[model samples]
Target chain A: MNATLNKPTSSTDVAQNGANRVNYVTPLANILESKDGYVLEAEMPGVNKDGLEVIVENGELTIVGRRAVAENRGREVYRESRAFDYRRAFELDPSIDTTKITAKIDQGVLTLHLPKAEAVKPRKITVG
Target chain B: MSIIRYQFPQVPNWSSSDRLASLRDEVNRLFDFSWPSRDSGLFSGWSPALDVFDDKDNLVVKVELPGLNKDEINISLDKGVLTVSGERKQEHESKEGESFRSERYFGKFHRSVTLPATVDSTKVSASYKDGILTVDLPKAEEAKPKQIAVNVA
Candidate 1:
């Protein structure tokens, strides 16, 4: 389970060219466990490389994704909702090595690999 | 969209994390102020939020469905109603250790919207990119806006 964070998008400071648009959403995420470590995956559909931010500080991890605004065409008759920028965070455990964490964003899914600390990795045991 | 659990009428049990997420959703709703949220328990798993908007020439339908594969989705147009149905499989299970937090929703979901009769179903086209599915339905010739020249009457 990962903690859902309300932290603002760290990459928001990066200048973007848009008329006037400010929308946000909490991106959904999934955490899976593996032998070597854990994998954190978050779905941020509209975000690209330049509009994404991932940070880990003080045992907290935050993923921020800013969606590129689309150019207005004619009119909006009905609006279920806008695909807004997404943001979410998770608290990290002491057993996970933050420095070794790696991330890759592909097809809107951001996958972060958190390697286990040396002491937490499972070891094989042999008996005579 | 808030999942309306009929079984549990009152489950406001909010953790700090879940509270934050719901708060953001509230703020989003406050700014947009769109009516008729997807709070109805039409599906027990999850309901994807979608929009049906029209431009000068065509009507467009966009649905937000992240982490869902394109092949898993099915879109159909029958009469004047457009239906989008899909399944998001739960691909993992926890064997040990208590889950710290989890808010991700997964399972099969079906959503449909009735389109205007003006929509030309023959010219309907859909494309999925970045997890957002956009379906375009062109307007029929008769439904298009006509500009009439008015001389000194």
Candidate 2:
């Protein structure tokens, strides 16, 4: 469970300019474990449905959210929010049923449901 | 023109780190008031972070408030001060499952900023998209920067 948290992207993997390297911030995430499986929720404040992607590959889950920068807004008098994208990866457990995983985004929050594999679920045996 | 590389360390929160973070933010806010360029606010619940920008015609303010319904937000401008207040409620309450991690903030939040220039209050427009609230306040005609021509002797 510890390994399934936020994972940062390596600098080498991105196309970096001398001055501009795409910045990525790990979105705040919550994970819940139930008898069925795990529920993961992430907060990506500026991302829209068109800019979100969730991929599962090689027993790993990755979520990337792109924030569209509005240009020509003018000279900034004050700033607290930074212009950055969101990226987080998680190493999926073998017991998770990747095929049954589901994801949805609403109001910049992403919720993912990862169900456990049938063979991994606890089953009660009856006397013959 | 430049991309910023900002990455936060990935720390597992076996403890209540969210409370610690909010406490740190409060401390920062206390010190931040000395610098007008960086001011969030001192609110009881949570305060949403915002940015202020001014072009020739308009002053644009953007606030980050995620997972909130449109009706939950309230915006008002009085005497050159713009205030944005909102409430973000948790979507669901579950008792059947156990939570491993919870990091998102849910509560009422309020933020206000005094405009640098006078704006046409009637023409102010606001829009909420992708969990971001953008308030566009058009500067008054008299407050716009005027260019003067000088004749060379």
Candidate 3:
């Protein structure tokens, strides 16, 4: 069951140093599997539709959400949230149909529908 | 607990922010295990993360509440305390699909913070955008910083 599920790539790819270092938080995600394929939902609170990027390359599905930093309204008295972007990438499985994958962002949640390849989909066989 | 994605692998090289993030993750894990659930009327199963910014004229409070309709959220300021409460109801209840990994939280949440300075409650305004709710509390006339000149005798 775990092998069929996608795994996120290493976080080292986004880490950098000095002024170029872009800090990010991994958005909470949920993966649901049905007969057709998988549904992935990621929570990215501060990202708008324009700031989101969903790309499939090299057998990997990468999601990056760029959040606009709010202007300094006043001194920070109490803070639990940080000004970090959201980024996470998953290795695509061979059984998944890459071309049929569709994505949409509503509010701050990004939903990706990854359909199973036709060859891997379950089929009922009738005995002749 | 069986989810492998939650456990971030410890690598040799880590950026400063990554290290801090790991530390925070560890702290969150500690709290999650230590206090599984507390019987409190003011709080619920989960609370949205928030930030409070204090500026000269107005104090801004931002809360992260993704996938929630604005109508679901309720904000109020009473007696110098700002309270934010909301419910994140599950959108789908699949009868057949199996969940591989479920990490996002759902249900009612509550959080309240005391204001550092006096604010005009009547003039308080809130706006929601991109799943973030921002409440602006303008400082009262007496709360605003005033520079008084000293008269030399």
What C-alpha lDDT, on a 0 to 100 scale, does residue B115 get in candidate 2?
Answer: 94
lDDT of 2 by residue, B21-138 (tens): 6567667776756644432435325656678999999999999887788889999999999999977887777687777776676677788888999999999999888888999999
Deviation in Å, model 3, residue B129 alpha carbon: 0.7
Q: How does residue B128 of candidate 2 score in lDDT?
A: 88
TM-score of each predicted structure versus truth: 0.72, 0.76, 0.80
Who wins the TM-score comparison? 3
lDDT (Cα, tens digit) per residue for candidate 1, span A1-128: 24232333442223344976554566666666665777777877766677789899888887789776765634655454544577766777677888999988765677788888888888888896
Fraction of real interface contacts that model 2 preserves: 0.79
Candidate 3: TM-score? 0.80
Model 3 clash tally, residue pairs: 3
- Minimal lDDT window, size 10, model 1 chain B: B5-14
Off by over 4 Å in 3: A2-4, A8-20, B1-44
Candidate 1: tens digits of C-alpha lDDT, residues B48-93: 7666777778888887777778898999988788999888886666
Residue B140, candidate 3: how far off, in angstroms?
A: 1.3
- Fill in the DockQ of model 3: 0.45
